[model samples]
Target: MSEQIETWGDLVERAGVGIGGTPSDAPVTKLISAPIPITGSDGTKDFGGCGSGCGCMPQA
Candidate 1:
């Protein structure tokens, strides 16, 4: 069986144009950010950071 491929233009044509306009409400004028501290071990757990089943040896 053959499969038919769809395109973005075809989908947009079927859906038609959408309502385009900015919301008539108050907009956010201020921004706030809180940096989170993170800590972890040096990636030398599984295969010494060489991924599982990888044949890598640690430096002497």
Candidate 2:
């Protein structure tokens, strides 16, 4: 089962795409959503960052 699962590094290495420290080379828009600040009823402010994950393309 482990073999069936491919990680981001594996895919990038297989595709020969250099994984730079930045997301400039990404084919897809890495920005899933803009930073959103939410205010609760208690007057507390919360900021949400990008969703968690490697943001890599799925294997075909």
Cα lDDT tens digits, model 2, 1-60, are 233313555546666897667444334323454233344446655423234442332222
Score residue 19 of candidate 1 by CA lDDT. Answer: 26
- For candidate 1, the TM-score is 0.21
TM-score of each: 0.21, 0.25
Every model: Cα RMSD to truth: 16.0, 11.9
- Tens-digit lDDT string for candidate 1 (6-57): 5444334445853235332323232222122122255434334343433343
User: What local lDDT does model 1 show for residue 55?
Assistant: 32
Q: Could you tell me the C-alpha RMSD of candidate 2 in Å? A: 11.9
Please report how far candidate 1 places residue 24 from its true position, in Å: 31
Backbone Cα, N, C clashes tallied per candidate: 0, 0
lDDT of 2: 0.44
